[model samples]
Target chain A: MNKKFLLLLFSLLALLVLALTPFIGMEKIPFDTILNFDSSNIHSDIFWRIRVPRILIAFISGSALAISGMAFQAMFRNALATPFTLGVSSGAAFGAALYVKIGFIFSLLGISGQTLFAFAGALVSIMLVYILSKVKKGFPVGTMLLAGVAINFFFSSFILFIQFISDFTNSFRIIRWLMGGFEVIGYSDIYNVIPFIIIGTIIIILLSTELNLLTLGEDVAVSRGVSLSKVKNILFFATSLMVSGVISVVGPIGFVGMMVPHISRLIIGADHRYLVLLNIIFGGAFLVLCDTLSRILIAPAEIPVGVITALLGGPFFIWLLIKSSNNNSI
Target chain B: MSKILFNIENLSFSISKKEILKSLSLKIYEGDYLSIIGPNGGGKTTLIKCLIKIYQSPVNKIFFKEQPIEKIPQKKLASQISYVPQINETNFPFTAKEFLMLARYPHLSRFSSVTAADTKAVASAFDITNTTNLANRFMNTLSGGEKQMIFIAAAFAQGGEVILLDEPATFLDPKHEHNVYQILKTIHQETNKTIVTVTHNINSAILNSNRIALIKNGKLDFYGNSVDITKNNILEKAYNKKFTFIKHPASEKSIIVPEVV
Candidate 1:
């Protein structure tokens, strides 16, 4: 608990840093300026409109991807399982892309159309994994992951197909979205996403004990006062929702989820009750640092936050995998 | 004089299209040290798995204390029955003590802090399993027998009404195997929790259990008191072998193992 507390405190300190990033760049941006400066000018516009929303979006999306990835990885007992691992990213992206191309058609539904459609897309892709996995009793981790991979491929091809035919005007936007970025974020994105993130994350945190029991093995979990079908179903959909909600707005960010949980597990045991909280805190800091590097290290032309995560996360995942295999006990 | 803790009636399970268990029915009463033994692919482990609700696939309509297993939430079921699976490959290298701490999981909610009572159970498990000194030792570092002891201790720490061991002694040395039986016997006697172990070690099963059931080809061949099984005729009939109920050649004590071919 002390270790977790320290991790949390450090994470809270990092969040403080993230909150300060817009004011800390090469330009003499100040916290006072953010509050007192007029919103009319280019500098103010860049800070309040573009940067604030983008940072919040990155924070929400990073937490969402990492937390959901932790849930998926724990449930599947697969380090490779991530927000994008099971094709949820591709599924949601495809749906959103289709909506972007056919915006005029969905404009018939009034406001919140594309985001809603994107959410639906993310939900549907997981639904595909669920349907495939649901066939033989409770969802086995192996089957769920395999289904996720297959769905990911299907959606990837679909995304490619959409990209291939998209006209000159929309091509650049589509390409940018595919590469993944944290720019041009809007307040609407925050309002649309923050509520779901809060609700979903709370439910998961509340059920952390069940998640811990699950780490012991399914039978052990069931025997220990957990209902396998109900909990797994709720957890699966809830996790998917968290990831979908974030990805629908800012696209997918990688590695924050995939890499952080294992490190926490390495620190603590496979106890989800502790792991979930630790992952959220550490994951937030880990992503904030990555995003900060993206903004400053590259200067005015910011690199996609996802790139930094992948570079760090991929190698870390291999090391953890080797460590887990070497020990050979879950 | 005993109450039925678990009742399985017409329970069926399948993997893909093939039926793993078919119309199997059995009733396990309280204080029954039951061992379900059979050959490979004989559904011994499968039956125990189903009873613990860890079958290859799910078993349909399992009953716990006359209530449907489906209706009983896992947390409550865990408070009543704890299962120790045959050791499989794992990635977490928990200490022997940490492994037993997992038994406290059922009694714990995600937000619930680990109480002293939970630690007490873990400590008790360590003491009973004779692995107290190995508390800080990594599970991966333990020898096969020591690891098995730690695993049993983990299951016992759950503090449930029943303990299910699925071949808990598999891959153990002779000394460790004997120790496992002794540990189970001590736990059953001291705690009065029902013990169900699945194994091929018929001798220990005979010695430690109050009753033994033969599970073969996904069916229960026979179920009776361990004392009754000492009868050569019944033993030979159920096992399809020749045997003599005699004392051990070296120890000069009652034993059931060596059979004539």
Candidate 2:
């Protein structure tokens, strides 16, 4: 734990350095001049409009996804499991598509419509999975995951259907939505997602011990004074809320939840406290790095943030399978 | 006087909804060592489950002495009587200490960290079961006998008044089986804790238990002292086979095994 804390501290410091690297390029905006009184106004615009939101988004989304991943992993007791394992991403995507079809309903409502619809969709999907399982005293794993797969497929297919029928303008917008890019990120996204992310992460930290007990299986968990249903309800609700917030704003940016927790578990053991925190830090760093690389890899034409995570995370997941088979302690 | 700690008014079993127990009743007094010997699927486990209130049967009307089974909270019930089920495939790599800590859960509140008392139980449980060396080892890494000792250690950690063991020696080696019986006997003698062991090992029941209640087709066929089970007619009726009681090789103790139909 001490070593992990040190590693996290080191990573945060490294992120600070990378965050500054953006200020020193061909467009070389001096650090202190970022908000100076005399300037071409490029420094303030770059810092406030682009760089800061991008960095903050990186930090918030990274931690939120990682913590949500840890919660899902512990709840399911499966290394491959993530928050979206129960169809949160697909459900949120479907919600966003529904919003697009209705043409800016938020202009009248004057609210962040994506976040609201995403949360509602995610919550409904979670409930749908639980309901579809034919729940007995408690939810069964095989039934729950199967329902998730079915729901995910249904929503994903609906998203594809929307893409197929919509006009070129709407289709291009849908393409960007699906392939997650963060170029136009602003303060509003941060304002919308931060509270849900912070509260959910803290609650998860407090519930870490309960999750550790839950790993011993339901009989042991229930015997240990944890109301099994309450733990499940809290975890599901928190993860859904956090993931829905992120997915609604950023679109379904897959793999942060899937790979980050696994890597964190490797660094720390099955202890959820360190696992959850480390995942957040590492996840944020990884995504921010990927998003930065995507911006520069094509220079003027930024790549989709999701592509880098997909390409890298998919192979890493496969390697985990191979490694875990050899090292069964995983 | 031995206080009646548990009473089973009726707990039956059936296959495909066919009735097995017909309003049967029994009493369990503290400091008593009772053995339940019966045929396969004779509702011994079912009756035990009803007493624990795992199933919602008409037999759930049974009580733990003065209070109804449902009335006593699960944690409180767990404190009074600990149940150690038969060994099965434990696929996960849970440690011995972690397994014992589960017993202390009923004694704890939410967010209440495990105290020195829990550590003491874990240490003593290790000492009692002689799993002190296997403390840090995963359950999957241990031998069957070692694992059985770990389960016994878990039950001991519960600090319950009554210990219910179902075929405890089912997967254990002979030496380990003897150790298990000796452990239970020591617990009964030292703590005066009530023991309810269900087993197919009739000789083990006769040797370790104070009394034997024979069951057939989910009903109590015979109930009496260990000495009373030595008769040919009782053995024949209980086992549905002819048997002879021969003195143990080195001791005055006797064993009754089936001879003929």
Candidate 3:
């Protein structure tokens, strides 16, 4: 198949999915009712107020995770890397859990305390990963990955400990947040996540060439005149900001990050120039589809979107592992 | 005498408090086909890295085109000198053309698209290295010889005046190894670009390079004409092994033969 044609077809398909998915769910919102602007119309209210914002949040969060995952994989030159690989999501979850335990109700500058704490926790985790990786001589990728996994375990245990000590109501709230969903009411979540996503996407696109070179090898990249440290720092900071922003809003959604980029790369080769954009479009559509399934699976009582992605993603991940081992390349 | 392209003044490099290159001073003249030869652990690769600023020497120690190496921006330095790294397995499945295009990084800005000149350079690189047929093939799928040719082609596409190759024929059959050297010789002769190669193939290095620098224990054991290598027991002293000199069948130049243990 022609690569450009394939890209265009997939892009159009993704757009179609994004366009059609907002009409699905427990509420039957007809096409005509979507055109009705009257506030009194319950169907219009549900379409505009509930479904649209939820889909937008899902699309944005998925796109952010997918692109960040793509960047991480290229940066580490490893296929298994994801947005949450460095425990940024776990760190943010811990922050939200701690906030719930403290019972903080204050909002700062129109942002909730939980979001702020989660962002802070994400930054803290990134800093710790950086410091830990620096303990080695040259910030080698193996050391960085091991450091990230260690930090991931460390934060996870802390989250578990916090959950253990909390009251039943708070414990339940923490568990619900950890499950990861898009139960957003309006465009507020959109506003909170859009800036980070936009900034991160732009940064990744700009450095797409460097990302391509880095994937070959660090020596090759440096020999080709890439400033390794500068590029790596920028990539880490951008991915952290983007991941933290989305995780703060939607809790720690998993598998979208790991799965979407891999799927995109499989369809399009590892040329990051096209891969990054494909990840955004396909990843967004994919999560919207998953979130729609979550909403309609049991009609009124919805399964968390995270559970659906994991259920699908786990098998896909194992299949990928097996395939990679067979070919000795991923 | 040709202008000096690179000048090293008492450059010393260390890693983890252990010195790897000890106060090495040398000058590389423009249009010089210089080969660096040494036994294992003799810092040949490290010297190439330092020349490209992959390993920074002490301040004011290494100079490129009379400017301090550290002061030169990496992109500018890259445009001036290109490197062909030792062969390693590439995991990514970049097509040969896509892989070669990455060599244009030093000449391109972030927003600049591929220009006509870039395309011409890449096409000419393929033409010169005779790898135009492999341009569409995935890099990982190519054999060692083909991959080495592609690496050389990438260096040509980079359009640097100087090409530094680290053991370009390390893991190839004799036919492929001879092909690599032939292409490099044609490139050096036709373009008059300075070529610095680090090679363990002592015979080929002596035959091809105009000058030879034999390093031993992080120091310059000998630096002189390639033919002069057979004089003064240089090979025996550097490798700590006895060698018998023999004349090449084609060119009648002196070549070394290792004595049986």
Candidate 4:
């Protein structure tokens, strides 16, 4: 099949999924009520206030994670690299857990205390990774990855300790947050995450050419005029900011970041120019569909979207590994 | 006398407190085909890297076109100089054409699409290297020699006057090695491009290059015309081993063979 044709077909399917997913849930809101724009109607109220905002957040967060994952994979030149590979998600989860444990109730700058703490945690992890990697002369990729893994483990253990000491309710809240979900009710969550996604996507798209050269090797990228340190710093900062923002709002959703980009690459090839756009659409639709399934899977008792993604992602990942090993193309 | 394209003045480099390139100084003139040859662990690769600014040389140590190379922005420097790194296996699946297109990075502005000039440069690169058939093929799928040619084509597509290659023909069969050198020779003669290649093949170095720089133990052992290389036992000194010099039957150029004990 033609790659462009596949891209177009996948994009159209994604658009259709995005358009249809909001209407799918435990209680189906009719398309007519959604189109009527009658906020007073109960069905319309559910469609406009509940489903729309949830889908919007889901789409935005999904795309953010996917693109960030794609960029990290390229920067590290490793297929398994994800947005959370550098511990941003773990750090954010630790912050949210700390907020639950300490019983913080206040909001700052119109942002919830939990969100603020999570973002702060992400910044700290980024700083730690940066400092650790900088100890080497060249800020080697392997060093950065190892540093991130160490930080991830450190924060993860702290979260577990916090959970161990907390009351049952607080422990449950932290556990739920760790599982990840879209329990959003209004437009506020959408407002919180859109800026990071837009800005980070722009930065990544602009550097798509550099990312292409980078996948070849550092020596190749530098010889071709990429400012290695400068590009790496900017990409790292942008991806961290985007991942931190999304994870802060929606908790730490796994698999989308690592999985979507590879699926996109398999579909569209590894050109970041097209891969970025495809990952955005495919990833967004994928999560929205998964989130909708989370709503309808058990009906009224929502399974965390994270659970659904993992359930699907683990099998898909295994299959991908097998397929790629057969062809020896990752 | 031709203009000097690169001037290295007392350049030294170190990593982890271990010196790799000692105070090295040499002049590379425009249109010159200079081959750097030495034993393993010598600073041959390091010298090529410094010239391409992969390793930052100290200020006033290296100059390109009479301007301090450190002062040139990386993009501009890349536009003036291109490098073909030692070929290695890559897992990336970028098509050969797409791979060639990335060579246009120095010439492209952020957010701008590839222009007609960029396309023409890439097409001409394929023509010159005679690897257009490999354009649509995935990079990793190509044979080692084919990949080497594509890399050279990428260097050509970069549109730089000077090309630096580190071991352009290593790990290849004899035919591919000859093909690699043949393409380099054509690029040099037809385009008048300045080429600095690092190789362990002393015979090919003497035959293909006008000048040779012999580096050993992070220092320059000799810098002179290729024909003068055999006169002072420089090969023997650089390798710390004995060699027998012989004239090539075809070109009558001086070549050397290691004398086995």
TM-scores, one per candidate: 0.88, 0.83, 0.95, 0.94
Model 1, position B165, has a per-residue lDDT of 87
Q: On residues B88-151, what C-alpha lDDT tens digit does candidate 4 reach at each position?
A: 7765578889989999999999868899999999999999999999999988789999999999
> Per-residue alpha-carbon lDDT of model 2 for B1-261, expressed as tens digits?
678877777665553577766666788777899998888867777666555444445635577877877676666777767777667654444578777876776676657788888889778878877779998887778888888888888888887878887788887789999989988888789778889988888898888888888777778877878766776588677667667788877655678755665
Better of 2 and 3 by lDDT: 3
Question: How many residue pairs in model 2 have overlapping backbones?
Answer: 0
Residue A301 of model 2, lDDT score? 76
Query: Tens digits of per-residue lDDT for model 3 on A1-330?
Result: 677887899889988987898887777788998889898999999999989999999998889999998988887676666657667778877787788888968777776777778878887887787666556544655456567778889988998899899999999988888888999997988887788789989999999999999888777888899988889899988987788878878889887888989888889888888999889888888999999999999989999888998899888767766776544334
Instruction: Give the winner by TM-score: 3 or 4.
Output: 3
Docking class of 3: medium
Residue-by-residue lDDT tens digits, candidate 2, A1-330: 475675668477657845764663335677777766443587777777777787778667877888888888777666656656668788887887777766776722333787778887888787886565435544555456567778889898888888788878887887798788676545877887777788888788888877876776655454434556777889888888888878877878887887888877767656675677677778877777788778778767778988888898788767865765544333
Q: Rate the local accuracy (lDDT) of all candidates.
A: 0.73, 0.74, 0.86, 0.86
A220 Cα displacement, candidate 3 (Å) = 0.5
B30-72 per-residue lDDT for model 3 (tens digits)? 9999999998887889889988877767889989999999899
Candidate 3 chain B, run of 10 with poorest lDDT: B85-94
lDDT of 3 at B99: 87
Instruction: Show the lowest summed lDDT stretch of 10 residues, model 1 chain B.
Output: B52-61
- Model 3: colliding residue pairs: none
Candidate 1 lDDT over residue span B110-152, tens digit each: 6668899999999998899888999989766778787778878
- Rank order by lDDT, top first? 3, 4, 2, 1
